[model samples]
Target chain A: MVKINGKEHEAAGKTIAQLVLDGGYKPERVAVELNLDIVPKAKYNDTVVKDGDSVEIVGFVGGG
Target chain B: MIPSKEEMFAALAERHGTDMQKKLSEASVAVCGLGGLGSNISIALARAGVGRLHIIDFDKVDISNLNRQQYFPDQLGIPKTEALEQTLSRIAPYCHITADTVKLTPDNIPSMLKDEKFICEAFDKADQKAMLVNTVLETYPDKYIVAGSGMAGTFSANLIHTRRVAGRFYLCGDEVNGVAEGEGLFASRVLVCAAHQAHMIIRLISGETEC
Candidate 1:
């Protein structure tokens, strides 16, 4: 089980990028934080999800 | 004749406790927007005796800004950075203010705000706020980010809060209200969140863990 934005989900043996896309967030639109560190945009696919891993996906909003 | 700095900050120093006054006199915080949240938050911070403020914005003060932003009728059509400078200077003559006119992007936000340990993200847009938060947290883990969200409608004042969203991020707002509600941004509610951010900065500056 992996935690996405603090919610538990089954994502074992999946790359961070794949899980992110499956979660309905576009690769280009959201920032991905795996565990405690950010997974740079270029390295999203290489980073895989494991049990107990935490992921935070935050999208950008229009600025004032 | 040049007036002494001590005399300029006399009353301000008296208002702040001795220890907090010393720290406030030496602390600097970056305000990332100059609209409703930025304008109000900047004024609150300046009046609170924060030693220095670096305010950045590229938009001019439109007539619409008068509704919720902190500015007088005479400030319409002037750049927000310039307008805010005028207001802050009057609030605290000794408070150092650097007003920069530039469009802040994710790539450049970190550079422009790199020097400040405490950062206030007061953008009207959620994307800009999120980008700034992610970039700053990733690059400068040591710094603190005071961000706002969802302070749009004239809702219950009790809904507004300063929540520690992350280890170094204190988000102040109702968190879901926006222009979509059709109520629009009101000054009183907006200031509630802005003051929350300002107070959080003061708390962090005075070496407190709670906000």
Candidate 2:
């Protein structure tokens, strides 16, 4: 199981884009981190999550 | 008669204790983006006697900004940095303010925020917010960044809060609502988030680092 946003999940071997989609956040409005490193938006579809990886997906909302 | 600078400092010391007041007076903070969040945050920091404030913004005040931003109708068309500086000086007569009317980009952030230990991210765009946070985190590992996010709509004022995201990076907002959801920004709700950011910065300066 891989950890996403501090919770364990069966998301190993999946792309960051899938994780973001499964989490119900817009692709353009959020940023993803795979194993403590920022995953650029362009690489979301290419970067794959492995077991024991800690992922943090933070969403951004408009407004000051 | 208006009190002298020394008298104002004495009054603040009496209220906050001399040591804490001194700490505040010696601290320098950079408030990026003079919008609703930045405007309110700057005023709170200045009133607390924070020694210096570096305010940056390239936009001018418009009629639409009057609803949530701290600007007057007569000040419309004036650059936000200038308008906010004029307002802050009246509240804290002795507070030193450096206002810049320029758009901040990745290349300029380093020099703009080099001397500030506390950085406030108050931009209105999600991409800009992320850019500032990422740049500062990567460029200045030791600096503390207090950012605002998701402060829109008519939700409960108590829903707004400050949370420590990662080491030395704190975020203030509901974390759920977004203006994209069709909920417009309200002054009351926006001000609540701004207060959270301001209070968090003050806590950091006072050695109370825990969020």
Candidate 3:
């Protein structure tokens, strides 16, 4: 099991895409970085998140 | 110590030590817009011993500005730049202050910001803010500007965030919550945003934080 945003989740070898979909957020609207490196958009489907991994997601909001 | 700029420097040297006092004497900053956030930022900068300050604002103080602008009632009709210049002189008499009562536009942004190391984008309108940012990005890539947005109405203090989006440019205030056109302003949100801007300015000036 792993924690996503502080909530415990069962790790089933979930890809980044699947995790984003489960979290109800649009992947295009947010940028994800694992271990301080940005994960390219094209690699979202291929990249996998292991247990106890930390990910930071920053979303774009409209601002002047 | 005798009572003068030299004497003040001597007194500050005794308090903060000579090296810190010398750094304070070498700092120079420019603040745009003399309204709410700008007013608070200018006061804080002056108090913090920033050696030189350039304040620019074209708007005149109005009755509505009394609530949160930090100007006295008698200064209602004076231009904001002039009012701030007078206020800062009384607050930090030894610091050098320059006031420009002119509006900033694309045509004059370069010359206006040439001498300023740090600029506070305190403009009230979104168009002006965008213009300043775009102009700085295009013309003067080296200059740093701290900008603010969504500082209106009653919102919790937790909503404000100070973030750096690029080199030498930090955006403060509530980006998610925007103030609608013609909406009335509140003191709490304005002060909160102003404090964030001032804090970032101090951090950048003191070398405690980098863009």
Each prediction's TM-score versus the true structure: 0.87, 0.90, 0.73
- Write one digit per residue (lDDT tens) for candidate 2, span B53-86: 9999999999999999999999999999989988
- Candidates sorted by lDDT, best first: 2, 1, 3
Sorted on TM-score, highest at the top, how do the candidates line up? 2, 1, 3
Model 1: lDDT of residue B1:
54
What TM-score does structure 3 among the candidates reach?
0.73
User: Residues B96-154, candidate 3, lDDT per residue (tens digit)?
Assistant: 99899999987898899899888898877665665666566556657777888777766
Question: Which structure is stronger by lDDT: 1 or 3?
Answer: 1
lDDT of 1 at A42: 65
Candidate 2, residue A57: how far the Cα is off, in Å = 1.9
Greater DockQ among 1 and 3 belongs to 1
Docking class of 2: medium
How would the candidate models be sorted by DockQ, starting from the highest? 2, 1, 3
Residue B20 miss distance in model 3 (angstroms) = 3.6
Which should have the higher TM-score, number 1 or number 2? 2
Give lDDT tens digits, candidate 3, residues A11-58: 548887787777775565444555434456667799888877656543
- Model 3 chain B is weakest, by summed lDDT over 10 consecutive residues, at B175-184
Give one digit per residue, the lDDT tens place, for model 1 in B1-211: 5457776567667777677888988899999999888988889888888888999998998888888898889988889999989989887778899999998886797689988899998887766676677778777869988888778776897898997655787778876676644658888888888889899999999999587
